[model samples]
Target chain A: MDSQVTRREVLKKGLIGAAGLTVLPSVIAACSTSSATTAPTAAAATQAPAATPTPNANILTGKLTLGNNHSDASDLKGVNAINDAFKALTTLAVTTNTVDHNTFQDQINNYLGATPDDVFFWFSGYRMRFFADKGLATAIDDTWAKVSSNFTAGFANAVVGNDKKVYGIPVDYYPWCVFYRKTLFADKKYTIPATWDDLITLCKKMQTDGLTPIAFSDKDGWPAMGTFDILNLRMNGYDFHVGLMTGAQKWTDPKVTAVFQKWATLIPFYTHGYAGLTWQQACDTLVRKTAGLFFLGLFMTGEVATVDATASADIDFFPFPFMGNSFDAEQALDAPIDIAMISAKSPNLAADLVNAKAYMEFWAKGSTQLLMYQANNGFIPTASDADTTKFDVLTQKAVQIVSKAQKITQFLDRDTRPDFAGANAMQSFLLNFLNAPTQDLAKLQASIQAFWDALPVYAGN
Target chain B: MSVTVMAGQRTAHNVARRRLSRGALYVFLTVLALIFLWPLLYAAYTSLRPYGEVVANPNGFFSTPATLNLNNYFFVWNGGNYPQFYLNTALITIPAVILTLWISSMVAFTISRFNWGFNMLVLMIFTAGNLLPPQVIIVPLYRLYNLIPVPAPLSDNGLMYDQIIGLILIHTTFQTGFCSFVLSNYMKTLSKELVEAAMIDGAGVFTIYARVIMPLVRPALAALGTLLFVWIYNDFFWSVMLFKSGDKRPITAALNNLQGTFFTDPTVVAAGSLMAAIPTIVLYLILQRYFISGLTLGSAKG
Candidate 1:
């Protein structure tokens, strides 16, 4: 009887304990609400300027939020310095939210869907258009109208959506070409090839010299796309390359197969075990003088600079050699533009618009572009009026190549829907082809076509 | 005398065999120890090397002359927001470990000591909660956290989405299931006579649990506490998804920011990882004895 009573008492206590545990969260919630009520008011006070109308204000004067993806230490420092300069020019206080670069790009959909900042860093081309078409990005035509004279027609077209309104402001661009060390070429008595046959001959010569001709890496799965894009641009015209990227031309078309066949011919000259190496590691090979040539963007200079500061001066690139076909002339090349856009879901749209436009106009100025270019010479300024006097020898040569080109194309990933490009479809497809170049082209084409066909049709305005 | 001599010879032979086997065991353990320590030594060695040297000799560590320096450590420490990350991790981990222990212990005590009709059913529910993968409920939990409005003191951003408190609450709630299962089985192995005797001595239920039950479960609590600390400290997924602001992220999540977009030096990454691993190693060392005892406590039920 005593044991039974003890058991009952224990059961009663357990019920009370469980009830207390259940009530604990609610208590915390209630306590948190009381303490947290002041924060929103504080936030609103900071955002108070947005509530008032500024009908005729020319210069934006308020707080502006910017989401930046320049997560590299050097790049972040440079960007922050630019923001500080912007703040000094206008009375607008800028709050910068810096996220990792890859994370920012991968999670952009969710980031934009939620309450995004007033302005966010992004890439130009179909990437900018896709967001603008979905109404996630605000039309920056009003800002573009002010800065129209500052940029070239090519840059302006890159930011314009299908709806005929600008969505982003292009800041900088870099061309992709065959980069080689000037010293290495000078030592080996190798001349820059001007045609497909000359390029192949040069590769064989380099091989006989006991040097890897091309330093290639596809571990990150996007560097190989550079080689593919250049080959396609050289083999087919820019129009067909763009068509293939946008899914307007079939992947199984003979034109596409021809591009792969051309790539396979040069595979023997590439660095062995490239599939496991990163682009930086590949660039290291070039820096260490083990490789002859590397087809990459001007950003390769960043890696070279780390090894030898003066080696950047010894770096020079020529546009991928002409293929001697129907489209024989080197009229096209890859020149991807980096851009910044205003988010449609910004909390204070009016204030955000004024601040974001001011920022765009600031970047449009040659003086502002000069500041950025001077800080990091990885890419050239987009502004035509930017001071070219301060450009390095490499930058000057890049300008020459870009100016000679009749048409410039964005890279494959930037030209297509991000879902298709990033969902391991194209990356893996290219890797599979690189691993076995002699595989049936028909089967490869079919797999790519099937993958593209299975995608849900994107509905956009 | 001859019989005694024969016995002495047999004893000496046995001693020789025992000594030989002990020597073999030592050799085996030494090899095992080296295998475990090899990666750590490599990481430490690589962290001390310059980025240029690391890149130049990717295939082997000893190919180049070892110029051990603290530059990588200095760069990682002074260059990044590691101090803030450490604070964030500690703030989340300490509370999470304590709450999980307290709540799990209370539940285990209730289930083990009580005679309620639904005791076994309740215990089953707690165990079953841990059976499901965390990924299965991540989306729902993400939405729920976003929807929940936390106070400013508890959350700087006024939402549960990017708050340390939210991480603590989630950790405590999700981990309680596993802790309660382990603690309850451990409690069952204890003698119930003491609890019955305490009740006869005019003690209440709380006194019996607090005085009689908890003191006996100290080893288990220490073991669970150490394990929970490491698990909560190393959590990457929830910290990344829940925190909107980079500043709000814990150490493990913040480690991703150490890598630059285009140029990441592996030496700096190695140094950062070694720094991040120090706390868990210290905790394990401190709790070594109790951890071992607690793990083997229920293994043999003789």
Candidate 2:
């Protein structure tokens, strides 16, 4: 009787109640309103077991709102095409918002309400863990399986939740590779280097030839993070990248130390004014033909377009030439972008989510892909055979490299273990610190390693 | 002939002096205007060009006139979820200004006129409230807001927890401390002759303040209102703390999203920034004449 009374007390206290009452009203209101507006379709509700099985009949409906990351109005086709298609498929509204990834959570908190919009585009890895733990996500596993095989996945087996549920989907995926000005390389009369020695020699030749070997920006500490991540991929290979992110390997390990060493040696090869330069500014070094190399992804193609659209073909991107190609170049490191998801506490939970799914699926394919490529001068996320006519020679090269890669590495932001991801910002900090000859490289190394030690260890299934 | 030539030389000399003073004034004003308009000028120039151009030519001020690319504005509006942001900002700023003014003026009138025994203590408490960091209140407030349930049958679409109204309430409450302090100080200058006359006429405290003293504080009110308007717009810490949707975002929150994304389109960003700036610039233009007068009035009265 005492236990029973305790349970009742807890319920009354709303500690663990019938539902989160703050969000309950919106849920109830949306349900009643949805019921009144549209008859529930006879589609089978996905009753897949939490393990592995196909889900049926869970058609996410209503307006699926996604946060637009890094895209402006001109990049509409990528985000809104799916929104349009979702509208065509259902009598529901879907929308998207463009937002900054840096302050995304802080920005979202300002709008927290019971009836939070049905869907939002946020991050994965540690950020996603924070949301998932807080119960912000709708755990769209059942919805995922229904459309799982429809579009191919980079890492189909590894993307599932602990209970074997899939949490997010892929939008655009790529390996953060060395994007070089092809014309500069050709003009310099240099062949593509086969090994690390060849790369160093090329950098020296470029330096001697009065050209910058690489372009980097440490202003936000991100361009350096790219430098660090790429070096880590080279030093430790893809497994170590996964291990370090999951807290399986200490960040201060000799292997990790080697990664930092690589960045330190390469710093001299970077642009002269990199300390205060933004990535966009640094990218201009390549676009305007001042610098020839940048270690970034196809995403940067968007920012450098005004330099000269044709010189984009002067660019050639290649994944870090692995000393050990355990896998084919196509099977090497590729980063997959996190997909759109429905919120558990959304206003019009059922209808809104179904509508949102349709839009996201459309975003993962078609003209959106082409617009993304043409606008950025990067590779589109499509099969190799998807019309090579529109692509310039530069983007076509990127397309050929991406198509044959069997396994794409997930983004460091997403693939890193959840706890460590929160502290991953420190990696960029240490790398920037390493660039200065005055700073103690040892201290920088320890500071980042300390944060790595502090992260919680969670075992992934 | 000599007298005529001398007269003509003297007239020409006078004209040159007058023209020189006018030229000096124009030069000075032009310099001052450039100083004042530099930020907007930079933002405008930056917005017109594509990111590549700016990167290649960071110091280029006027070599080209790039069209004020509407790409960023429309992108922000449609793709960035700026519509919800505008709505949320309105919700937070409007109520915060109105209610704080009303509450502060009332508190000020009572404190200034009523000879309450602990009035000084009350004033001191309110004055000291500004010393604490707002972050101290955040955790408690979050829990408190979470615990306080919304009434039943609440609209699903309406924001109860993190909407603009909630932000308005927090800001309104926080601002009252300073508003009351300023109002009370301003009210002290209310001529003793008027108060004495009112008291002799058997006018109640409320009636005296409402009829006599309130009208006198119009300039003070205007000064306070403008300050409040700028504060709400420039705010970053709380707006992010309170509101989550991109649609409900303010200019500050939205501006932050510009450079960090994978997309490095600087042209779109510059355009969006210019768009965000337009209203504030227009507001100042509308209110500048009265604004300075209000400030001068408060300082002189004090």
Candidate 3:
């Protein structure tokens, strides 16, 4: 009886404590509300107007968001600096933007729906065609016609859509090459190979020395596309290259077979554990001096150079040498990613388009080009003013190949179905090849055939 | 007297053999545990390595001279927008956990005590809700959230952190269905005599619940909180869609930013990945005792 009475008293106290806990939240809220001002009119009134020389609400003046290293539409300048620039440029305080490489497609999707940037960075080629197809990017042909410079002319055609309408101003004419460790080659008494067979022999020598000859990450679906493009250009030529990608040519063509054969030879010479490794990991092979060469995009300069600045200087590149050319002018595998576009339905549409034009012109300047090169060394310049000499000796050779190349082709994966790039066709090609190498040559042939057969119309063959 | 002593000695030998078998069982369980835990251990181990070290020795995980560089942690904390993300996550998780415990407990109590119109139907609906694919609802929910006239301060640059409420709602609402089912089943098995006795003593329904039910469910609360914390922390998709800006983003989002097209730097990636892992690991460590006890109690027949 005494214990039961004590329990009741304890329960009564617990109930009182619970009631007090409930009202405590309200009391805190009341105190906060009494002290807080809901509006910031007083703060806004005291602030000076941001400095915008000839601030035209009409210009829709905002900083151009360029893709970083391999990121989607973000600024070349890092986020905080980009935000400040955008704020100063627009006189409307812009906060921040972010981008990622693997997840760029989704980021683009998010940007398209909610807040399409005023002047976003983008790539050139069939990659740009999608934005043009969706009517997301505006035509800047008029602006291009007015800017009378060799850079504009060189890049103008690349950004033009299939409709013959220009959608974006091309910033990068990225030319990919076979980049190798110059130190490794020199140490082995190996000169940069001139022919396909010579390259093979060099790879064999490297393998004998227990070194990987090439560093390619097929795990990153797009990087292996470089090998195919380079090989196909050598075997078939530019027309076939365009035909196969545009879905006009058959995958079972003799040209594709030759290209596939080249890849088969190259496979044994590449770094170990290539199956799920990303391109960056592949780059690590070179950075560690375990591998010799890699077929990377012309834009790879930025990527390869960023591998610890001290170590990166040791890295250099060469033109991906071919046994021969597909066309009279040398054809190489290269294209663009990060294709910026403008909205057709934007209320600030025309003004935004003008700013976009101005941004292109502004970004294309030699000073700005120098700025970009300084910021990210591997940035391939479409503009003539860009000092290609800033690159190492081997990179200069690659730039020579790029500048004088007859026809620059697109990376096959990006030029194909954007959704399906890493999903089915290319995925099957790499995985099936890697796992089932001993199965049969017929198995490889059949895999390519199956994708080509089931491909939807408008998928470039 | 000699024969009886010999028989007792044989019995003792048999008891020793049985103890040996139990020890073998433990050894077998430990081996299986190691097999399951090896990948997690490897990931944690890799996390401790610097970027350059891991890159230099991709295949050399065991042998790599990795020093415990907390730099990756510092990078993720300041660079990854963790403070803001944590605030947003807390707003969602705390309220959701409380609401789940409160509402689920009430439902369980009512179900255990009383049968009413549509009680079974409500229970079935929750079960059905849990079974439906979360992905199927994403499009509709995206549309619905967009239509909410209460101007959810869209940064108008990209989607902002305020919209994390959408993710919170989704997680809370979905988890409630699964969590409530488990909790209700446990509540049903609870001794009915205590509640009945309290009612007989003239205690009200809530009073009986307050006195009899909560103390009994402490273990359940701990088990659910730990489980949900692990799931919610590791979640990527909801965080990706719901949060956009680097400042508004979580550690996972920050890690994504490190993947540049120009260069492949897996060092920063490995470091960043390590930082993301530590919190949940710490949570797991702290709650492991409760997890073991609660699970044993819930599964075992008393």
Candidate 4:
């Protein structure tokens, strides 16, 4: 009987706890209502300033929301610093919502289609235009009109929609190039290859010297696309490459087959078991002085610097060797630009338009870009006036390379529809080629074309 | 005397054979345990080393204690918003688990105790809900969440979308099907005599449910609670899909914050993953006995 009474008391306490647990959401929800109540007053501030040409003249004061995808520790700090600068200059209170970088990229379509923040981070090139064409993003042409003189023609074209309206502010970009340790090159007395034949001879020499001629890895699937992009740009031209990505050109074009046939010849010189190694592991060979050359982005310096802080000083890169084609002089390369844009679907877009435009205009400044560049040097500023004197040797050279280019393309994924360029599609298709480089090029091209043809047509909103 | 000697020799030979077999079994179990523990051991080892050390000597299988440090943990802990994420996860998980257990147990009592015309069909329907993949209905569900207008205290947004309450509802609704099926079968094993005795003693249905059946199924409830807590706590997909604010996300979502788009510190990521797993590990340890019994409970007759 004593045990039974004790059990009853225990049961009574459990019931009370269960009831209390069920009521917790309401308490949380109630607490959050304080912030929620402020949203309406901010939204009600939408006045007769939608027609104003001068964003600064309005002195807009209200709450604006921003969605950021730079979730990395240093990157998040950079974003916060930029926001702090913006808040200091303007009366608008910015609410920045940060999501995981990859998650943000994966769910962008769903996010933009639903309720989106007033302003958000994005990539330039086809993706920026793709969303603008779908009417998911606001046209910041007025903001661009004021700041166009601050940027270059390449950046100006990058943010333009199919309808020729400017949609975003191009903030920063990093280029893909062949990186090598300058000390190794100096020790071996190796000259930077200027032509395809010279590159082959250098690889042969590196092989005889008992070094992996090219440190390569395709485990991430996207790294292989870098090789393909540079090869295509060298063999064909910028127009042809962009046409292929946009489906205006066929994959089975003899020119496309030629690029793969050329890549197959250099496959033997890649690091052994590259399919099982990540880009970082491949980058390690360069760091350890076991490899002759590494072909990757400017961001490779960031990876190497983490291991050896002084290593980046020894790192240098040359553009991929000329393939003796007419497009060689075009100096085309993949320098994907990161942009920031305002979302059209934001509920407070009307009220937030003035402040959002101010935020967009603020990003257009070279000084603003310099702030972010200092925070994370992996991304070089696109604005021409961003103090070049502040750059490290590699960044200075990278800027010169980008500015000299007659044509520029975004990375493959950023240049095409996400579904076609996603992990299941182009990533695997590229992996399939690398697994067996000697496979029939014609059949591979046909399969690539078939995959593109079968995709549902992307209908704009 | 010769016959007795032969019997003694046979017993000694049998003992030798049993000893050899036991040794082999022990060897097999040791290898299996090592294979299962390899990934966890590797992560823990990697988490202790500095990022540069791991990068320089990725294949280093053996290292001195001097090389191993908690810098990676400190780096991730200092960098990430772990405390807020933990609070967010707790808010979503505890309530969802309790609600799911309470609702399912009542449904189990009703279905198992009384003889109703639709009892078997109801159980089958509940079981079948578990078979439908959550992905199939996500698009429509997203639209539905946006369309639904909720009160202020229930949802700060004044809508079901992007609210913590929305996550709790979805978790409870989806998990109830599996919990109800398991609890009903367990409730069936309880003798009807107890219910009949309670009814005879002027006990109402609610009284019998609260006083009699709940106490009996405490073990199963504890097991289910542990499982549900972990599932809801570690949920990445629903929270990612439903919540818009970064600070509103749970701990599982916080792991992604350690990984960068262009650059990542693998040691920091490994440390973050282990840190995120601590709560679930602690809960499993506490309820392990009930969990083990819960698994085997339905296999044997009561």
Candidate 5:
């Protein structure tokens, strides 16, 4: 009986002990992850390299590692193809480390602070500038000097850091446009809308024809920002849009209110229960001809092709219709460019700096960009000398559309500070407006400004 | 005779009532269990279907079996870097769990057996360590790991950062706190006379702990060992934060590889997740008897 009692006590103690240990830490993990912020590290403060990257008589033979976020099947293939091509040209062996796209973005702060790869794939605009300002990325002026003539002013500006030095090489970019099935349009006998009123009329026509006038989803939070970007760009022009993104212009301004009001006009045309759906599911609607239009990036083609390979051919898009304002002829659009840059903290940087710079220079060349473009045509080359003759019909039309634009913006998240643009900030605000578009605009605008004001200034900035 | 007959009829009626209630209770429990299992079943169903078809009709589960295939499983297995991920997780988790148990048991034995002045204080200190959130220490820990140099066999880069040994060390360090607290409490319930008797027989503290206390605590250790294995295996925060090399990450982090920039095949992701869950499920099943007995042993003290 004594033994039995002691054994029972032992088991009870063990249960309580083990349970406390296993369960509580996971709860702590959940709470702590949200508060994880990057502190500015003491990375090097050197400016642009002074010397031209003329290879010395000594052969460069060390390996250069790359941190890549292009994990999509074809995107990975495209990246690999470029690496293989770059390998054939130099004695430097290149190793690519591929991480999931979203995780890579979330972990970028820690990754760059740690032992980062010698070179890495990243976005242009503020996202690039954010890290560069932290002294995380190496400025590549020498590499840019060799490749400057191959790119345009837009591409050049996208890669420039706040310090006015080039931090990365522009590889490819995809424009955001209104995509619809060409066959569905022809069947409905719909003419392309060139003006705001014409667009409303077309939506009404599409609705009467038993189609969802617009397919929209913000379950992922960032998708709704596209609609906001286009509406703001159309109503207020590129300068105001940039000012608002940079917080130089207040959200409560009349021009910003006007953009929101205009967007409210098209709210009735959107698919119902959109807040629960993903962009992929919404893209399925456009592919199935259940929806008349989807305002998204050019990557919509990839989503479409995954569902039905033949259906991608029927996909066509037009820029958002003119808003009948002064910014109409500005022809501005979001053409977010992907970039490749060098890490200042890479342990192998000293051994492989020459090859790394050579690789960046290689990425800038039109021929090297063509290798990736050939593997994945969804992304148009940023280089001016990229062969247009090899472009497919869609690629040719995309290039033509981008070429005509007088001003270009990166996407909303790309253009703003990451902390302010994260899911908790603009993402949730946009989601709130979408969930209840009729909510008090004044209060919502105040909330946005307050959130922006509350953010700590970037230490390095 | 009538009185006896009336009693017999009442007994039969009561028996019938009890059987009906039992049937209803079983029905309720069965329904609850199916609800719990629905997600896993649905994931299995999705994994067997073509990714395209599943994406096109996310809710349509009434497809023919002919449309179901193992292509997604094959893709996740053959195409993904899962072999390396599994190997890395094993290298990290196995040693971490073993060391946590070994160190914790020794700590537990000392505090529970001895009548030292700081015995409770030592236990409290270990318990308090568990209360510190890992995020608060990540930056400092990262800097510390970078500063510490390991021998060539343990770390490829000389520093502890981005190495398997570093992950193991962190997991062991973080887990030992909770484990020691629980274990010391468990050991305290043991008969002190047993340790006193052994000591009188010329047994040292280590001998008493190994020969007597260890045998008594085997059930508790088994339970903890199982729980620790699962917790450490599923850890994403530490490995993803500390490791720079993608190839060195564990299987939990490998699930992100199936997600693409533009599009993700939910079916393929479901397949990969299900495969990742396999080892944990198997471990639980094998140790299920010990787990159950460990949790219930002291509850019926009355």
Candidate 6:
């Protein structure tokens, strides 16, 4: 009986131990699997440059981590192609950690606060400035010096902080404009409006023809900001708009009120149930010929192409019609520029900075931007010297519009404090305005101002 | 003869009343079933259709029969890296469920079977921990995870930030509370005489807990184990927050990665969701008998 009890005790201990033992190897194996997969890519990075050495080969070496938000398959392909090009040109081994695009943007503060990648994708304007001021991002002034000739002064200015330090390398930009179907315009004999009065007349004509004049959606809460930004820029001019965004100018000012009042005039012509629909759904209304026009970024082509591949050919856009105000040059447009920046919290800061600067320098090259543009034509290349000869008709038109502009503003969200913009302050205000346009503009403006005041003032700002 | 005829007519009336009520019940049940099944049916139907067709007819479910194909499943399986995500999920789920069950059961066994100082307080602590919202702890937990360093063999990044073990630990820690609570209560309902009998028979604490008490609480364990598996498997927030690497993310979190930045194909998303649902569905089905009984077992006592 004693022997039997001992055996039973031993068996129980063995079972308990086995449960613990089973998990360890699996954990190790899982880690090994991830490391093994990355090992091949690192190996490939070193081996490829050996096959065909270019002029700038071996300029930078060692593994550089890149936090990429290019979650789209097509965009990922383009980014990968560019990275491969960079690896081939300069022997830097870049290991990319891709995250969901929207999530990446939302969690960027936390990601940067932690051990972030050596280099990461970001946008320019106040958003870049905010991070740069926080010392979260490394200044790429050395990189800028090498590629200064490739970009315009405007592009360079977008990347500079308030402290006069370059923080990011602008890669591509897309303009927010009034997108319309060319074929539908042709069928209806509708002429592209050149001014605010012409636009109102066109809207009236569209309404008479039994169509929604504007395909508007604010379901995602940021699309309507595009409309508000364009209106504010048109009505208040660039300086006031920028001042208002930076909280230097009061939201309750008459200038802001006028912008809202002007926006109210077009509410009758917007798509019914606009709040229920997403931007893609609004774009669908245009694609299906149910709506006359959509005011969105150049990415609208992506939605149109998804439904009918050939329909993209019929898609064209014009600048939001000049509002016939003091700032009626159509100069101030929303042209959000995507930029790449090196993180200050990089694990191997010195070595990673070398690789990151080299990568940014390569990105700033016109030839490199041209290669990227060739891979994905969603946005215009930022480099002034980028090859535009091969640009599609729509892209060329976008370039022409941007080139002629005296001022370009990033979108409303990108221009202001993220806390104010991201926390439904502007979005809800715009949504409320959309819901009841004629309701107290003063109250709306006051609320917006109050919310802005409530934010913890950034010391750097 | 008149009385007999009246009696027969009353019987016929009663039969008709019963049949009418039964018909109503059937109708109600059918409606309820359809209400529950419609979303699954829609997902399945949408996953079979081409993306363009679905986009064109977003409101309609049964349009464009010609566009229906298995292409989306193929795309989700091959293009979405779903197999890798599934493996990641399994790696996190299995160990988490086992550890949670083992640890929580031990706690439950000790608290229920023995009278010790601060036993109720310990149980209260575990139970109260489960009540706090996950978001409240996210920031502190995120910082903590980043600070803790593990060996290279345990984490490719050599930190807890993107480790599967980190995910498992969080899942186990968070889930153990509810599991132990339910389990302790369930074990309390079991007759103390059985444990007393074991103690009198010279059985050790481990022997009593493992051999005598454990077998009695199989139903509760099975139920909690199933619940833990489903919850951890379907977890998206912790997985995404804890792991930055796409390679380490579970299937639920990986679904977000399948979405294109500019254009997400709806059919592909539907297909991916359906694929992710399969493992949990299979698990629930296999554990169905024990699950229902186990859930009701505690309530049955009171």
Error of model 1, residue B29, in angstroms: 1.3
lDDT (C-alpha, whole model) for all candidates: 0.81, 0.62, 0.62, 0.84, 0.84, 0.84
Tell me the fnat of candidate 4.
0.47
**The best candidate in terms of DockQ:** 4
For model 4, residues A1-461, the per-residue Cα lDDT tens digits are 99878766765665566566446546765666576445432333345444344545535566678989988767777888888888777645678888989888877887887777889999997788888988899998899999999898998999988888999999999999999989999999999999999999999999999999999998888899999999999999999999999999999999998989899999999999999888988998899888988889888887898987878788899988998879989999999999999999876788778788889888888888888888889878888778889998889899988888999999998898877887889898888888899998899899999999999987631
User: Which DockQ-derived CAPRI band holds candidate 2?
Assistant: incorrect
Candidate 3 vs 5: which has more DockQ? 5
The two-chain DockQ for each candidate, comma-separated, is 0.18, 0.16, 0.22, 0.31, 0.28, 0.24
| Model 6 lDDT per residue over B109-139, tens place | 9999899889899999999999998989998
lDDT of 1 by residue, A65-111 (tens): 78888877777777877887886766566777788787677668766
lDDT of 2 by residue, A289-320 (tens): 66867878777776655555676556677766
lDDT of 2 by residue, B1-302 (tens): 99989999989998999899999999999999999999777777666665544555645434565444655567666655554445445556767899889998998888887786999999889879867789999767765654454442431233345455567777788888888888888898887789889889999877888899889888778878877876776678776665445445666776775654555565666776776665455455455544576455435443
Q: Cα RMSDs of all predictions?
A: 8.2, 13.1, 7.5, 5.2, 7.4, 7.1
What tens digits encode model 3's per-residue C-alpha lDDT throughout A1-461? 99878766765665566466446545644544432233111122123432234654523433333323234222345334433444465554432244565555566655455434455555666667776676666776776665437464436667678778777655555567777766777788888877788899888988888888888787756677777777777777777877877667877776676676667877878777787887777776777788888878655545554445566667666667777553534655564533344545332333344555655555555545555544554455566776766755654665677667666776776666564455577766766776555556666766676776675656221
What is candidate 1's lDDT per residue for B125-211, written digit by digit as tens? 998998888788887888787678776567644567667898999899889998998898899989889898999999998998899
- The DockQ-derived docking category for candidate 4 is acceptable
> What is the Cα-based TM-score of model 4?
0.90
Query: What DockQ would candidate 5 receive versus the native complex?
Result: 0.28
**Candidate 2 interface RMSD to the true structure:** 15.0
Q: What is the two-chain DockQ of model 2?
A: 0.16
Interface RMSD, per-candidate values to 1 decimal: 9.9, 15.0, 9.4, 5.7, 9.7, 7.4
For all predicted structures, in order, the TM-scores are 0.89, 0.76, 0.79, 0.90, 0.89, 0.90
